[model samples]
Target: MAGETDPLATEQPPLSAGDLPAELPGELIAPEVAALEVPPELVAQSLGEYVRAWGARIRGGDPGVLPVILGLAIIAVLFQIVSPGNVFLSAGNLVNLFQQSAVFMVLGMAEIFVLLLGEIDLSTGYVAGLAGVIGVQLVQPVTTNFPWWVAIMAALLACAVIGAAQGTLVARLRLPSFVVTLGGNLIFNGVMLWALLFGPFSGYPTLGDQTNPHVLYQLMWGTIDPLIGWIILTALVVVVGGSFWLRDSRRRRSGLVAPPVSLTALKIVLIAVVGAAVVAICNINRAHFGTIEGVPWVILIVIGLLGLWTVLLQRTRFGRYIYAIGGNPEASRRAGINLVRVRTLAFVLCSMTAGLAGLLYVANQGGASNNFPGGQYVLYAVAAAVIGGTSLFGGRGRVLHGVLGGLVIGGINNGLYLLGLDVKVQFVVTGFVLLAAVTIDALSRRGASVGSVAHI
Candidate 1:
């Protein structure tokens, strides 16, 4: 019997792994398996679900700029109540606040470009001064007698070139950004001093005479007509609202988890209210000539710049690369991004924006000065960016954050000035605010890391 082949075991082809079937025996299937069902309400389908998701996101380490906005509102109300006759809430003071925020708004944005790459640019302040001086000299009879706009462009070009060189050192040499930018700050400041002190100037500390064109000066002091402001505001509201709605709808149609239509509408309505308020306030007859002023050019410039930068950072491949690099440099490199180019471009862009800020500063002051405290200005820029909820660790910020932060800073300064607070008190208050912002950033990051670990 052992040597004989049984009828059931008759010789045949061998069963290969591929010949194995997946069908289980009839007894193996569980009866409960057929009863399993997913509930519809458990899935995110309504505005409430969307809000819950946002709350979860916040709890998971993204507090966003909501705190800053709330802080701004709180500060405004506090100042309004404490200040005599609610002077801080006056239209004149509010107008001044917008004008005051322009420099930092630009500088804060400039810092963001580098900050997104987890880098810092300490030289932005001095770079701004140098660029501003160059602009003044070129447009004046004391130098090349170039057009004001040409002078501005040339100055920005110079800043870009300077940034590129420094970036080369940072990207190619792999030097520490803090050290490199520190040296740059000193060098640029020295250059600014030399130019103002000896370079074709009639006197120390300033470039160009009264005979110089007032175009640059007008930047900080000019306002558009009411009609133009209304038109621009309308266009912006309609276009921005439509675009946001369309984007959400498209995402939803494509089966993505887009925000609820109600949320989108709320955002649109809020924007419209704010826009209308600004326009209406500006259109009030405040001038001695009794003419209707629409909006300050500086405000328009800041908004335009904010929009442009938001597009760049949120919608571009270069921006994506910047974030990727900041998140993980090695991963970004392995993904075939040209790390050196992106880093270098970031530095150049930072300096160029600083250069624009410099122009605005000079415009605000009515002339370029060697005595500009660029170091202090840079600190303010950093503070603004941080306070607006941009993470110091990089890769987690938006240009809008910078704008909001700048506004916060401007509001504080304006409110303090109106309250007749001492300069020392202002400094102490600002320091505290900055410290709080940094603390928030640190805590949020730690929380997020912990949350991720728990998930894992």
Candidate 2:
């Protein structure tokens, strides 16, 4: 009775609404106390936390396919601006672009091996020229009378030997690559001059005694078939799409942040569009008197090389080691990687690729001449590689970069020619572009180190 007495006594006085607190009546005090205890400082801190989290999410590497697509768009705009009336966008011109960029692509792939190892090979162009000269000479009656295939093999082997020797000097002797390669450059050029002095090395076996024929020259020109182009485009789409899908799935399964589905789809669409455009442009007949079809064999060769080099760099253990060495040689050596073998192979491959390029050049030109200067061409090749995105300092480039860079240079040349600019001006502009590319690469790398989004 005593314990229950307060229940009625407490309820005797009814409180007015004005006398009650704003909070719900008869609510537990603990909850109110907890709510009131939250600090003003904490509220401010929570807002700051939320803002920082949001900033991070937006700036993270998941910007969809915007960057790549945007880059391509910009390239298109630039080309259009440089060449009025969109002449650069013509189908025949597009095929020409591929042909023009092909040599650069091959050289770029070759350069990738040495680049990955953080070494330089200056003799690529000379070696290539020499290989071509020697190859042609071997097949000529005045020389060895060898089969065409045999001549090609001989040229490649010679290049390989030269490359290996240079590599040995750099790796085994512990010489600086720049010095070794620079010397090789001089030596190879001298050899090329010596080969060219005695007789004409005609590249074409079937042409017979003619220096240059208009009909044969026309045959050398490339053409594009719309149907074939479309077929190739379809194949490319399937391959590229499959690769992306597989890659994304693997990344997701491995707990990595994969590209958004939207981004992937967008990339596919853009690639398809570009591919189709290229095919369509190439299908157009540029010559009013005659017709040209599909991309030149040269373009095919370059694309093939690009694909091969990409695989080598991205998939092979040797490629991995090359990059590791470039990134940090000491770490690679400590990890039991064979620096000598890798470096040697790199030089050999570089030279061999150069040789192939030389063959293409001779084929394009119809004959080899004593006045041919391999030194100048070598410089162009180096410039092309650097311009395309292969870092002169190494460890940060791709084969495709070389192709693009080559095209950029080629574009400048073509554009200037269309505008009736002088050769000297072309050279100056190309040099400037090369310098700019290197500067950009250095700056981008620095920015990357500093954690900036604008580094690229």
Best prediction by lDDT: 1
RMSD of 1: 12.5
Write the residue-wise lDDT of candidate 1 on 1-456 in tens digits.
Answer: 578642212243444556555665553343221111111122346768656655665676677887898989988898889887886777767787888989988988989988888999999999999988887777776557778889889999999999999999999999999999999999999998877764545534243344444777767777999999999999999999999899989988998766678877887898899999999888876666767376988888888988888888888888888888888876667556778888999999999989999988888887776679899888988888999988888788999888888888888887888788877887788889889999999998998777555543
Candidate 2 per-residue lDDT, tens place, 1-456, comes to 555542111222344567556775333334322222222222222445433433442343222222323433555567767776777667666666666555565666677678767788888878888987776666665546666677778889999999999999998898998899889888888888787665543333322343332222222353446577788779988898879878867976897656555556666888889777766666676666876666555655676677788788777777777777888876566556777778888898899988887776666666566655577677778777777767777676777776766777677776676567898988998888778777766765664444432221
In model 1, the runs with Cα more than 4 Å from the true position are 1-45, 198-200, 203-212, 255-257, 288-292
- Give the Å shift of residue 167 in candidate 2: 1.1
Full-model lDDT, candidate 2? 0.67
Q: Rate residue 108 of model 2 by lDDT.
A: 61
Q: For each candidate in the order shown, give its overall lDDT on alpha carbons.
A: 0.81, 0.67
* Best-matching candidate per TM-score: 1
RMSD each, Å: 12.5, 19.1
